[model samples]
Target: MDQHVKTLAHLFLDGEEDKALHFTEELLNEYSLMSFYEAIITPAMYYIGELWETNQISVADEHLATAICDFVISQIKGKETVRSGNDQSSGRALFFGMEEEQHYIGLKMVSESFKAHGYQVRYLGPNLSLEHSLIQINKFKPEVIGLSAALSYRLPGLKEIIKRFSELEWKPLIMIGGRMARKFALEELEADQVMIVKDLHHLSKWFEEGREGLINETS
Candidate 1:
């Protein structure tokens, strides 16, 4: 993990896109997808975010790093694999980033993760209106509705969206993630059936626990 972390940090921070891509591919060849995401991709991005927070790096640097990581994740996710457990998928889902929230890589990763698990995942990237999101949800009729907001300022918007979703007569399971997700408790939000997911591991664990759908059912 340390070796991969250093490699990712060097490649990503130095603006070496081709090198970064090659390095990521090499890691994928040598390790599991989850290992690459958890050990290299996720941790590296978190460090980059922290660097921006502490003024160690410029916003442009952070954005570039994120874009590169985004490309790498998408590349890995596009690879074919033989899934082992249930022959059937867990369920369909619609994912989006909240209004004016531009940090969307995390949500993108979630989309890829769902797709890996054979879920019909619809990823509407970044800064979508509630009304627009609702339209997709209605159209998709997904079993899960996912929301991500990296900015704390978007919490009110997130709250409003979740509240409106809760009022729906036939609501899907709602999952929210991002840095701000850790700031507030669920009870404070006054919404049941709403889950706060911190990372891909937690999201997959939710699937394994049979919370999202019948993932453990026989093939």
Candidate 2:
């Protein structure tokens, strides 16, 4: 909410990682990394996209903005959140992008939302091979595995990955979210836990409602 935080977030959106990191650390120390992200960074990203779409900024500038935001996000995610007081741990979730799908911003945002809702989020970063990802799933044993695909064409590859996982005898709740999932619809994916994302707020609300682990049964 502070003007300086907004300014720093804009700087980050404009691809100024050094300045963004400095400001992020200051605010994070005062508040929390999640607060800095929600209050400034996310809004700044939307603003940057708007500027680019409206021709106020160039494609190169938009890419630069994304780079800076990713850097700042890495910084924020490195900082731990306040521990949930509940003795019973909520389910663990893993988020990643399919191989050849370079976009990870959506995955990052959704992972943060899950974490805020008390899920242990294991973020595997971007462009991971299906084999490597399955190894991660086996290693971490998360209750949910979320794959994010930015483009629609990547859906088939994502499905292949899911099929590979299914063969492993132990399959986690596989949720896919992003532009592809939202537009193409999750019914087409045939995954047991697919959900269409209306927006970040909707995703957050869904996670909150399901934090107790009975969303499907109640519905």
Candidate 3:
């Protein structure tokens, strides 16, 4: 796509962690945190996924790229202060990958996005079991619960998880995201309590336009 994204993708695929981090820092100077995620890093990782899907890269290569990307995200996050106007009282949010779903870079990005906007976030990373997730949900009692899945096969499990979460009396908002959310028509999963966040850009709009009202409704 864009030159920066292509170069960043190359860096990730090459497993140049230091170079990738430097490139990411340069991008941060040009883009806001959310925009950097939406426009640059996201597209680069998607390109890496395309390479893997088309057999242009080995599974080990793909994992290397993912590891580099993860390192870059962590480096950037470590250096930045929270955005000035955000309120820590925004509310609590818990994020995790669906059972058996191991792709969690997108989930990590989503958690950081929420943190940038000042939400209290618990990012449990990938492949958390339903029983464990419910235990955290019951204890955290977050206003929003975000789940991710990258593969199509996880759809049935995703639906089942949503169903169980819906039955909770507090009725936390359920947010579905990741590659599956973008590639498939997930409108069937959307209801008064469920939302499909297609990308970081969409999530930013939700924070700006809908977050407060939805949090109040859940509260």
Candidate 4:
């Protein structure tokens, strides 16, 4: 854990937006966008969530912290796109959360990872139905369909979505990520169609391997 990351989290929790942003910017100079995300920002977010879960902070406090974190990440996202060299066809991915699952920050960070690496990310956000997602998948025709479920209760919805994907003939690869996502056995759903990303580093590796597999299959 970077020492500055702990300070950043404390600033965010204290609702010192300007200082937090400044701290995040300073860290940006020390880390790549994804590295900052996977290290500092993500852990800061986890701490915020933990604070809320333990009743140490109010909902408004949590929301404010998240907003600050989101703003910082958006700043990095712009830089990423400019340096991506305009390769629009690197691959496409449709990202969404299960129905009634409102947690989107983690999913959005993952989407940014894809975008930073030149993948076209179609983010549908949270509270999406399987039917709706299927429609988007057909329209998007993404190489990957990414889903996230931040809460354990939403796992059923995530499972249902995976089931539908498995039943499809031309299903895209599925990548699941979130705090609670590790509780499930995603591999049992199907072969080469489902994966569980344990962290941002694993997510990076998964995209690399998944892209190679897609290329191999297509060629």
Alpha-carbon RMSD of each model? 4.1, 4.3, 2.9, 3.4
Candidate 4 wrongly placed segments (more than 4 Å):
84-88, 183-185, 208-219
lDDT tens digits, residue span 149-174, model 2: 77877767877876766665555667
Q: Write the per-residue lDDT of candidate 1 for residues 41-159, one digit (tens) a residue.
A: 77788788788899999988888888778777777785523543435677898899888888887788788877777788899999999999889888888888888877666677788
- CA lDDT of every candidate: 0.75, 0.69, 0.86, 0.76
Counted clashes in each candidate structure: 0, 0, 0, 0
- Model 1 ranges off by over 4 Å: 29-31, 80-88, 190-192, 212-219
**Poorest lDDT segment (10 consecutive residues) of candidate 3:** 78-87
- After superposition, the stretches of candidate 2 with alpha carbons farther than 4 Å from their true spots are 1-9, 13-43, 53-60, 78-80, 83-89, 211-219
Clashing pairs in 2: none
Candidate ranking under lDDT, highest first, comes to: 3, 4, 1, 2
Where does the lowest 10-residue lDDT sum fall in candidate 2? 210-219
- Report how far residue 161 has shifted in candidate 4, in Å: 0.9
Top candidate by TM-score: 3
Q: Write the per-residue lDDT of candidate 4 for residues 17-78, one digit (tens) a residue.
A: 77877787787777876778888888877777888999999999988887777776676686
lDDT digits (tens) for residues 34-102 of candidate 3: 889899989998899999999999999999999999999887873444544664457899999987788
